[model samples]
Target chain A: MSVLDRLAPELITGAPLLVMQGIAKRYGPVVALEDVAATVWPGEVLGIVGESGSGKSTLLRMMNLEDTPDTGTYTLALPEVAGNLFDLDRFARRQLCARRIGIVYQNPHQGLLMGHSSSGNVAERLLVAGERRFATLRARAREALDVSEFPLNRMDDPPRLLSGGMQQRVQLAKAIALEPALLLLDEPTTGLDVSVQALVLDTLKRLQRDRAITMVIVSHDLGVIRTMADRVMVMRRGRVVEEGLVDQVFQDPQHPYTQELVHAKL
Target chain B: MPNSERGAMVPGAVVLQVEGLAKSFQMHHLGQNLHAFDHVSFTLRAGEFLLLKGPNGVGKSTLLRTIYRSYLPQAGHVWFSHGAGRTDLAHAADVDIALLRRREIGFVTQFLIARPRVAAEDIVAEPLRKAGVAAEDALEQARHWLATFGVKRDLWRAYPTSFSGGEQQKVNLARALILPPRLLLLDEPTASLDVGARAALVARLADLKAAGVAMIGVFHHPGDVAALVDRDLMLMAKEVDDVAV
Candidate 1:
């Protein structure tokens, strides 16, 4: 079945969970991002590609409404709620982001508290998602760990003692613990070696398939984006240089920059 | 463990040796005990890169602490053998170990908790200062090492606190390399770095290995250790095994 077919019929009926139109952001004298438009459909993985200082992070922040864009039309079809993300007040935006979205940082060490155990790491996010019952939190955390292919037997070990690959898996379990509708992964496997990177990415793709978890993965590595993304948006100099299906963008990239990236991959 | 390839040098000329090392802690508050390291021991040659691998709480930290003389082991002896000087550290004085650390060993802990908000350059110079080098000469040596580690000249004066974890790691690395100690101990040195930064650090560590600066790297990730180390030192429940390269 197609990605949209996996989603609930109600969500697919002309309802884009995230919609960004002409979003723009500036930091002092520098314009970090400008004129970015995209749509994240339920059960689909959207890849965002850009180099350092190219404002890919700014775009990801704007997508989840973490940072307000200077000027843009932004709308989110959140579960049981709908609003313009850019226009929402602080509390409202935070509430929406917390309930419907989750973000995983690139630096695995900073993403999760290294002092806490695997179960503790997963439960922290569940508690934040408003699930406070101790037994329920444990159940959910274990379930998430199972889905992410994490070794549940070693759930009591602190993150610092776990292997680097296992640490990244704990970060994944934290993000997906609450079954967030939209997941944002920023260079999820950057520092990990090839074997660990393969494991983590495979786990992510499986969860995205089984749970219909829509994702927005940001990466400087084109290979990473190509592997996970159903739809790709190329960002450069704070703008959308190209946007299309992954196959179309990778096979017949329209932008000259896109051509260079594809050529580099070969 | 003994070094089999003792050629012109004496067979017992191994730089360092440990036999049946073990450590445990009594948690008085919980009325329970924690075994940090158990029956773990290995040998270090003049320039060997020893990589320690295990899960969290599996005693990697404890092993490093024991080797660096920070935490005394409950059982097992840590000995240093170099040239005519053979020192058994199990019964060595704390002050003597401290002196040895200052003069012969350099250590980098896993966490980067800043103590002094000194400039990156001066922070590296502190070790040389303790070694009795002139302040001006120490600063020049520090600058050379910093440049070697790829820290820009403009950023030399920047406080380590202001830099990212990777930058701070480079500073720590520079500090450890400035003294040119006989042995270097690292715990999770690349945990906080990105791909580019990690590659740079690994490249530098390879150079250090070539120069025969004996090192013991405690790493949680086998992949990271696999890239730079020559052999694996896997820590099982209460024993240590030297996995072949």
Candidate 2:
């Protein structure tokens, strides 16, 4: 049975799947992020939009436990786990990052090592997730690549030989090969052509819908933010300036920063 | 010369032309051929921004590498025309052509980086070292380029890999453009850039074009191609389509 199935129906239906309280991060004299509080419920997509240096990336990294917050309370909805992300032990957090949470970076090159082949890239994550059978892992990787629309016949080609769009599809396949519950996408389609961007976004939407994977997408493109988000958070100067449903944020933005961002792209 | 007069190039006066271009990769596991580019062809004018666009595995990046002579084309011919001379790059000696490449072409890859932990200022200055320019002068020029892209001056001695994605892209652009070449080949130059940094790149490319420096931009973003390209050349799944923008 799935983790969700084992939880109390009341807890599964009503509680926030992930919650952050008084989250803050600092670097020397600079205040990167401060007093950020948010909640991500199951079966929901949360979008984060901000200008450069607004701490969106930093905040996302904090949430993924890639960086430690100076002060914060993070509680994830993992019944099998005993503590929050910050409270978890080293091995536990590593397990969580590798198995439950996955990151898809904007630059596809960053997601996978340049030296590894497509099959190797996919296998690395599956191996880390404790799958040891070689034949089973290879077959699972192939199936995942097929699901992501990757041309599986070129499984051994290194990333350098693949086009940027193709490499991204492979990256997506690797990220989802383990069936992670939370996927953090950092401007996933920022540099792709519009036609290619459309396809990637469509694939992501389909995967989210079919698997009910909770996502936190960080981007400066309002077009992408509008298309994928259920709820939107507008950030500025390391704080949440405004928050609302996607339609509400786009239609009646109350914050000046959000308004500026919307108009700048226009 | 008038604009119309300048637009005219003699028949077969192509500076860079490719015909029946094809390349394939022999995959290890699948044990089959992966065609990087399939029978792609295009003729580029001397000073034009020819944008190549396509979905990821469509061989757009491979086409660029093939054109630059970095990746040898398994088939077809790439002809480069220079004043009073024309040479097929496929037949040129690797070392001699590499020297030509350094002087006449500037190619920036998607995974651009400097030496292991090299300072940003030094990285930019590396290209101009043999130009007889003073070290201080080269650094000044580097700083000028960095400021144009909104990179802080205090980060000059800092390594770019330690910087953010946007910042590293700016440094990469600065390094490639510090010593202007006749042809600039950019692969997704603004991939990690913010709006501010991207605008700076657009403006710089515009200035380079105005100066009659030829550029061939391989970009995915329509906004980027619209900003810098004079024409669009697309590499579809296995076909090449050239269209004037």
Candidate 1 TM-score versus the reference: 0.49
Residue-level lDDT of model 2, residues B151-245, one tens digit each, is 89899899786788778888888888877666678888878888888888888888766655667877767686585567877777766766666
For model 2, the DockQ equals 0.01
Off by over 4 Å in 2: A1-12, B1-245
TM-score for each candidate, following the candidate numbering: 0.49, 0.50
CA displacement after TM-score superposition, residue A218 of candidate 2 (Å) = 0.5
Model 2, A137: alpha-carbon shift in Å? 0.6
**What range of 10 consecutive residues in model 2 chain A has the weakest lDDT sum?**
A2-11
Candidate 1 Cα deviation (angstroms), residue A227: 1.2
- Candidate 2: tens digits of C-alpha lDDT, residues A1-266: 21111112221235667788898888998889989987787767889999899999888887778888889988888777655578887788888888888888888777898678898898888998899999998998898888887898898898779977788888888988988878888998889988788778877876875677889999988888887877788888889997765754664444566666766777
* DockQ for all models: 0.01, 0.01
Model 1 achieves a DockQ score of 0.01
